[model samples]
Target chain A: MVGIVGYGAYIPRYRIKVDQIAGVWGADVQSYRKGLLVEEKSVPAPDQDTITMAVEASKRAIKRAGIDPREIGAVYVGSESHPYAVKPSGTVLAEAIGACPEVHTADLEFACKAGTEGMYLAMSLVKAGEIKYGLAVGADTSQGAPGDPLEYTTAAGAAAFIFGHDKILAEVVETYSYTTDTPDFWRREYQYYPRHGGRFTGDPAYFKHIIGAGRGIMAKAAIKPEDIKYVIFHQPNGKFPLRVGELLGFKKEQIEPGLLVTYLGNTYSGSSPLGLTATFDIAKPGDLILIVSFGSGAGSDAFLFRMTERIEEVKDLAPKTRETLEGPKVYVDYGTYAKFRKKIRKANE
Target chain B: MPTPARYWREIPQRYRLEAGRCRRCGFIAFPPRLICPGCRSREFEIIKLAEEGRVISYTIIRVPPHQFVDQAPYAVGIVELDDGVKLMGQIVDCPFEELRTGLRVRIEFRKIMEEGEAGIIYYGYKFVPA
Candidate 1:
């Protein structure tokens, strides 16, 4: 069976604190940690966008797999924000990945689940002998309204996975999915901030779908909650995943390693895969991992994976905290955050 | 007024912070190139850089570009920008004795050189102490 040959993740160097957003809005006083379920979030520089992050992650994934990029037969990008509305992000990615000209190329968008959805598709292709190898990537730079809690945690990042039949880092054990049509979160055409059914998002939609998906996968695989070595859930905040995990019987240790959403906040599409990559960093050869994704407006995909011996050969390829993300913040005033988010227009000189 | 040949291709960058970058890694070439040394992607992005950078390395340009002859004894250094990009430009407004790695400098738009005898007055961004 085809499986994850290699994987890599990226988080930009800059992070913003949720309290910083609260201080600017003058809203009800709340702990930043409680509000966004995030303490800090990553920010990409002007030049670094979804494409650049994908390329960086792709390079690392390619290296970890120890395969020539030209050997790959397909490239798929899963992103909400493509640089040019008309341009193909997959083509730029293919060029960067050095994929052969004969490869198939495509871009997929299924909110947050698109990354793993692409992963499964790649597995099917490579498994069926349609292609020698395939690449799947999920990356995004979501916009949050300035002063809103989402602004504090709606950060940027990328993660890429390569799938093939041999030398797999982790073999796919079982897969299950629970999809639904719920308006938990959504953005319309030309809309900057996503319109979300706030209460609906946190409780009924996210929790329900995530819980359902995890349970479905667990039940289908006949693997009890204790059997999972690591569980990575789509992180909108620090609390949701923990809540879902506990309700489903996964203890703190099994889920703690991937809770970057608590610190780096919600990276939209990048969150779940990056969380998985983090889990892979500490995983042992026989470890079984479960990853669940929650995308607003809304669906969930759960993946069951077992680590392979090759994962131990190179341990350094994993998601990490950037030094800038650790730097002392500037304690940005509301005006500056507004400028940074392009919320307010400043008059020209 | 500008001469035809100089006006068409290489004239402008001779005066400022314009350079070609590797289409692949986005690494900018200093004396810009037709082919990027980084990844060698034939295609490239053209950029007008911010002049101010930290002194990555330095030397007094005791020998100067022909156009900069009158500006002898000038200090030259490689400055890495706050943006994590590195580029080369003359270090102005600070004495040669003061220039060192990690020194803060600001970019000022100015003329770097002009071709002799009937060249357009060149304009470029140069680094000055912030």
Candidate 2:
């Protein structure tokens, strides 16, 4: 019954409202508000990046796990915005949490699904008895081009999960993955911002993969939507997850707790993992949770988890997802956001 | 070019807030000293310094060094940790005017500096409002 032993999430303090971003490009704010269902998105401080956020979240996870950091045998970080192109984010995270010298670490990228990929690998390794404990993190300081539609939602945040055989908070019952070669969104090497296929990112991409994995996992686990207490889908936006949930026979109530994109925006690799963290915040013992993550290269990784009594003990060990989302947020105007995002060009040094 | 070895050697302190506490006099040293200055103790225990602290003094760097020109006007402060170890770091996530002696803060991992646009990024601890 290898599963999550501890989990933690981190959201930056700074935020930029949807209207503020819309006003810059003279886009209709009401359309985005009504359509995407995103209000404001988190922004990372200049000093914060993928690695920094991952380290913070992993620290909280270590605290919650209450296990010796030296016991962790593997560290994997999933992010599209890793600070160094070559250096692994996992190594820094491992060192920060005092898990160095004995840990195997790697950085993963599959767009938004990268985090779940790490989760899948870590859980599998733990289940196989290949490691005593494994740490997986999904985090990103996602990039969007200036005045591009992606700018409104591309945001920063991170979530980490520690997998082990003992003290399981949520027991992994089943796992499923659906993937294909779909070029819906991509950023070329040396490109600062990603380019997307716009409407092409829908139906054939996010929806198809998510529904395939969601239904596939439900079938493999031999459970109906009514049997699950909560469902979290990779939330590129508030609308997509809701619509997809309904399509998968889940009610609005079951999906709403994890529907954080309305406030947190799209944190890329952090999206679904953060949602699962939020669901874990309120889920009870014996509750069933289904988390399905979608990445732009076009794939979904779905996992079915059954909560254990230990969930109560560690849910409050770190900052709750909702508390951080609704905590004291420093709102930045578009100009400040541009500066923070480093949109303005400067002369050569 | 800045030497990576210099940065590499400080990983224990920079990444984990590791310090050396003298076994004889209980003097705590950041960067983990080889010999205790207080009691001349050669033996020590490596420990992590307290993460939470309070500002004892601070100065706003309005004109920063070459590497930190963009981050000028930031507040740098000396902090006294709960364990009595004093250290200097940048104070962030608060208004400059709000900073004062005795304000509570906690250490957070952050990017301290990077070498130009394409070099090794140095990460360390910074103070944030607790």
Candidate 3:
């Protein structure tokens, strides 16, 4: 019965249109927009990073969970862009949420699926009766090389899930992970941005693991695609999740609600978790949801969850993911975007 | 560079906005002190300050400090929290022209500054338009 008690999402209010970025490189704007199915992508402020966004998301989660901060026994943050390379991001998050001194904290890294790894760990800890509550957060201020194709999709966002057995919002049915030694994408030590294996990141890395984990979880849960009301997959681009869903026998309508990559772009570790939070904002009680996430190291974590009646009571406790996505966004040009992301070297440098 | 002790010591005031209220004369002090400035009272109570506040005054730093050189021409302000405590921090996520006396604002956790090229990052609270 250990499952999500509450969830929250944070999508930064700044957006840069595909046309805006394409204009800088003299690339075909129409082609990128059509190819990726993404109109614009979120950008984090210079001050905002993985730790700050994680704290904000975790705060909303605590509000929705309606639980004491002291009651949270563990805090796990998953991110590739942790502010400090040596310091643990989870400790800062836990202290910010007032869940300090007696909390187990860890900063995890597994590319796009890192957040779900935290979720899986939190659920396990809660189910084991060792902890009353655990908080799992996936957040990234993801970076891409200037003028690279990855810049168009790598974005900033965060999502948090509070796990507890009491007052469950989405009851966990089963979970599974499919992983292998596939180095489709990687950022080596001392590297500021990640490098990918170009087209190789597609079929062999993301698609294979996601499909394998998705089907494996459904089989383990003894359910078919038609039995699930909603589906969310790790969205490296807007097209991947839709195509993967159809490949797994899910209708477009079943995956559309959670397919937010068209707007927010790929938030790396926050990708699938943010989609799940958005789905939860609109899902009805008893609706079954299937979530599968792929990380490009590579691996996929799949989960089957059933919405609980308590969802309605707490869904509005924090800001909705859609509202943040559709809210008034301050659009920035390339120069400003570079300044905000600290891409341009200062005169002093 | 901010030492580990300095960052650790300021966590209560920086992270949680925990201030100190004097037992005598009811004076509040940010970055909580053992002796109240108002009455020199040794007795104090820890108080969590209100998140919402108003801008009392502001200054745009056109020539910035070392770590903030790239982010020059940014606005920093003195904010008066609803609890009557005032703290100085940067004003973010708003246009500089819009900054005025008594502008409604809310505090958010943000990176205050980085120490050096490869030093511990210092995070603190900043004011954003509410």
Best by DockQ: 2
RMSD of each: 10.5, 0.8, 1.7
- Model 3, A163-270: lDDT tens per residue? 999989999999999999999999999988889999999899988999999989988988989999989999988888888898999999999999999989999999
Consecutive 10-residue window with the lowest summed lDDT within model 1 chain A: A321-330
Residue B66, candidate 3: Cα error in Å is 2.7
Each model's TM-score, in the order given? 0.73, 0.99, 0.96
Residue clash pairs of candidate 3? none
Candidate 1 clashing pairs, residues 3+ apart or interchain:
none
Residue A196 lDDT (model 2): 98
| Candidate 1 local lDDT, A143-236, one digit each (tens) | 7776555676787888899999888989999888888788777778878777777677877788888899998998899989898889999988
Whichever of 1 and 2 has more DockQ, that candidate is: 2
How much DockQ does model 3 earn? 0.72
Candidate whose TM-score is highest:
2
What DockQ results do all the predictions give, each relative to the true complex?
Answer: 0.05, 0.88, 0.72
Candidate 2 TM-score versus the reference? 0.99
> What value of lDDT does candidate 1 attain over all alpha carbons?
0.74
Order of the predicted models by lDDT, top scorer first: 2, 3, 1
